[model samples]
Target: MKTIDPINTTNPNGFKNQASAALEDTNLQTALQRAKSGFIEKRKKAIHLVDDFEHLKTQAQQAKQSALDNLNHHLALFEKNVVASGGAVHRAKTPAELNQIVLKICQQQNAKLVTKGKSMVSEETHLNAFLEKHGISTAETDLGEYIIQLAKEKPSHIIAPAVHKTRQQVAELFKHNHELGERDLEEIRALVDEARAMLRKAFLLADVGITGANLLVADTGSVAIVTNEGNGDLTATLPKTHIVTASIEKVVANMEDAGKILQVLGRSATGQAMSTYTSFFNGPRRTEDLDGPSAFHVVILDNGRSDILNSKYKDMMRCIKCGACLNHCPVYGAVGGHAYGDVYPGPMGSVLTPLMKGIEQATPLPNASTFCGRCEEVCPMSIPLPELLRQLRNDQATKGLAPKLQSMALGIYGWLARKPRLFQLTMGMFGRVVKLFKVSHILPQETPAPDAPDTFVQQWKKSKQGHSENE
Candidate 1:
């Protein structure tokens, strides 16, 4: 209902500033505690259940790479399949064009109340804002999304929109916005009950239901989506018109390919044996179906991806949105999602936001990594996240977008280190300078007291002298 800009909402110390502040907020601590453990533990158990899960990961990653390497080929195959399956396909080369195409559908259908089921593509386009600007009322049916919608904030994490919210906040929000007096289970259930009731009405009366796809099959022209809450199922089935928005690369070759994707997606993302509901819509519903939307539209969005093809950074397109990369990232663990200041966050967000918006707008994002490879290690799609980040860092440094003082300091250090004599002299002087503080005596052994008698060069000299390392 209200507009949330990523740039204005996120704090800028990257994650440390937000996480330390969050540590003190009892409410946020409670909200994040579950998120931190629950996701990892559940996924661990789920991944262990499958045979060949590791091998499957390798296969999936290779498959995604193949798709990205030859995207135009796959996209054409996808378009042909969808048309054959009776769905209309629209290609939007830009966000503004995507918005116009979606609005045209809503206006044509005389849509007044639109119910949504967690489409990130819609978030990418700021569709709610665009639609509301034209007087169309949109409601988010996913519980986390509904909480965020009520709060008038952007999703902190892609998969878990309100991952940053505490139960008390939800309780307070329900009380303030929907009249959940006293916040009892009767009240909480009443709140849940209330959302179900409200959304139920919107579903019945809505002319259009909009959603984002988890995957698209080029072989059958089908829209594949996974959800725990079943809201996606309702939004698609109950409405007269169903509209799906997704980036251009979501297409896979066939149902078998989609299954391989789902295998890793559930395990890596949430650690579930299977998502509660998985739907494959082959062009709305067939005439044989008793209940289904009469018309189905799939909008392919390419706001900025086409140019990334064959570029060093295009591996980003391999993301499946499982949130595994976010879960495993050290920086993401420390700061949480809000700091990156975008629809996506953590490693995946860092790679995606820069690619979509340009490194110029998000120069700080590349440096957000600690060069931690966990995100890439666990990526089911095996995207070279650290490699991409390294490239972006180089891009920023070359462009003078990196902090001048830090860059200059590194340059000086590099020059000195290249010459051993100058390097040793500089190091010895630096050590003596730190020694002057007398504070070095109190410092932990982990840090070599710059003046520590056994510096790297000292060890190197001793090794050349054939002295024992310990001596």
Candidate 2:
């Protein structure tokens, strides 16, 4: 296996600092504000239009459950079907193995330039960086992905890779990278056209193309890619060789199962009934085919997912990569994806990251949530995100991965929670100090903190004194 360069998996105890910095970044704030309500409102409108939206969600969940229940069986059947279709399936137990498999395919083809579609699994494994380090130039075809590629950043959102970027920021990135002279790319159409023109050249010249799967069908050995831009079609078709990098959990029983999930995936991710391009590539181009890749390969990675399947975090594997959970999450809307300090972020990432990288490295992620339950509420696949996060926190506590200071604070809080009288007294004193801070203008005067109400003990005592006086 080829040794891939180490990417930043997670920052140790860095979520708070990263979140504070994100809160302060003017550009990020502008982009986030623009996007915060759009996804929420659009999804609301889209889901409302469908009379059976909840039914679709239920069907999707059932399909996912069925797939997971027979994961190994479906994977085996998928591999068999792929081989029967004249395509190859590579099972990688780790990221290193996946990278090596992809690299070996490229090297065998003597690939000099690789054109890529939006593959979050590739991002998860740091595939672009790995390929570039080994001397292969890569081009990102998706407009959002292309922008982020130039910016040298991982995707902030699964569907909208460059959602953190504003039109102005995109204009700057284009002006810096492309040779277009003094063009007004302030408009989205202009920026998109410029990227499309640039990517078209790379698409024709590249030897290999790589994409991620929305779902893999076991019955036909097809890799289904759902995209709005149609760039994924070009990326998969133009190159001589096509490579798909997906996790093992993406496999489904058949095309029917794929359709069941697809119904919910589009509405949940981008508020579309159907994406512009939902292409399925089963194998290499047939002799009668006009166009397609000469070779097709599917690289399925485990990368701690196998461990998750057996553990309490198994529900996470049902995620369809719909950005709905992130869009609906208040914490994600405020701080954006980068603050979580990993490739994945928001509610799903909080649970997935700690499991993938271990609780020690990703201790802050599970604690990043407010337990608002919006993620689970909006998830089309019905994944229980809050429950899974609580599981990670419990695992962390069990392993003693939490900081001593935090442990001490929690210990004190636990003690206070147990003693009713002492807790009431402490709360009364704390409320007075808060009121004092407000009165003296010690805290921010712009936003007044709500003074704590009288404790239960005090209220009870006052009622008793009033009764005694009446008697």
List lDDT for all candidates, in order: 0.81, 0.88
Q: Candidate 1 at residue 241, lDDT? A: 91
For candidate 2, what is the lDDT? 0.88
List candidate 1 stretches off by more than 4 Å. 1-8, 11-26, 180-183, 186-191, 438-443, 446-456, 459-471
Clashing pairs in 2: none
Best by TM-score: 2
Instruction: Give the candidate number with the greatest lDDT.
Output: 2
Candidate 2 least-lDDT 10 residues: 1-10
Colliding residue pairs in candidate 1? 43-271, 184-187
What would the TM-scores of all predictions be?
A: 0.91, 0.93
Residue 268 shift from truth in candidate 1, angstroms: 0.7
* TM-score (C-alpha, index-matched) for candidate 2: 0.93
